[model samples]
Target: MSGIKIIVITFLLCLFIINSICKNDICINKSNGFYADYTSLNCQTFYFCFNETLNKTLQCLNSSEPIFSTYRQRCIGVNPLYDECYLVNINENHENCAWFSVQLSTTSNLTYHYSCLYPFLFDLESKGCKHYSQVQCNQRFEPKDACDYHHPQIHSSIDERPCWLIPSCRNKTNGFHGNQLQECSSYYECKDERFLNLTTCPKNMHFSDKSKTCLITLSNCENSTKF
Candidate 1:
């Protein structure tokens, strides 16, 4: 019985090895005859083919998976000969595609095979080259005699009027004064009589009479004594 158990274990192990070999062979066969050329731009290289099946497969591979097979199903059964493939060359410096690729592999049903020749889709902007129109706009912003005056100065102060009076006192009125007052002056009396009655006068002004008149001493009043 022990010898029989050993034989059974060996048979299962052999079957597992055969299954693995067949799977690898299938992958190898699928990779054969598929070729892509990567064109680099802005330090990134990309490949594009109009074949729908290949395109769909690549799109699925690019996305996060667990849904990879479901995504792959969108294009896998289509004829490979008629399908196009797009491979975006990842920019090492940019890291956007690299991170995306890692996530895609982790989450998807597709595995990266080093033997496969993945192509790149060329994008001029990604290659560090600017379009002609963009170059023109960049030139317009450069220093030029025609635009020197038109370009606003970097540092400018608003033409602010001097604050001649405190903001709160601008509309307030001066209060009446009795005789023995040294001089007549303008004072800030709040429109609300209660505020005038309750609030103390500011340092530069003084309350003259009980009626809410505040006084600013002025030397030019005609009746200086009645101020």
Candidate 2:
């Protein structure tokens, strides 16, 4: 063979070998039969193998609504001391609740039974209490105010009233210098403190020779003008 043809044949053989190894490493076996690629949607990472009798019980429950109730009594017969068995309602709105039961039971001993009554099933995990009637997938707790009693406060807005202090006279009054009241509402000293200027002072009012402070005196000048 020519040197160029030999090089091309060698490259083709190498490419074929790499492709074969890639195909073998990616194959995954799903429970529903077909061998799928690892990245395929049908191939899940987790698997569980229940008892054959339990598997048959679940299969019967999945088929019909009435069979779930009938299987519950039969389940108790299989294990009278069964700790958990729940009856759940299977309506259009309560479909997610049914799915939740199936998902939770994958790792737990809880068995879901279907019913037409107000409470569809008794949850064995919750001490035979009824599961939530309806499941809201994205339901969230949004309280109106920060002081609401039910939900725990996780975060708060900086603009909220409880987080800031409002400017007011009650927090402003500091002390009196001679007869003049020297009041301050802030933490910093006022630079331009003068009579009738209305300067905002800090905790300590700036006093320049005490005369700059204002005095509130009782006025009787109308009766005794000359005095």
Question: What is the total number of backbone clashes in candidate 2?
Answer: 8
Model 1 accuracy (lDDT, Cα): 0.28
TM-score of each: 0.18, 0.17
Query: Which digits, one per residue and each the tens of the lDDT, describe model 1 over residues 51-87?
Result: 2112211232322221212112222323322222333
Candidate 2 residue-wise lDDT, 42-122, digit = tens: 222212212211111122222222121221222122233332222233222122222222212233444333321211222
Candidate 1 lDDT score at position 50: 32
Which parts of model 2 have CA positions greater than 4 angstroms off?
A: 28-32, 35-227
Considering every candidate listed, which one attains the maximal lDDT? 1
Model-by-model lDDT, in order? Answer: 0.28, 0.27
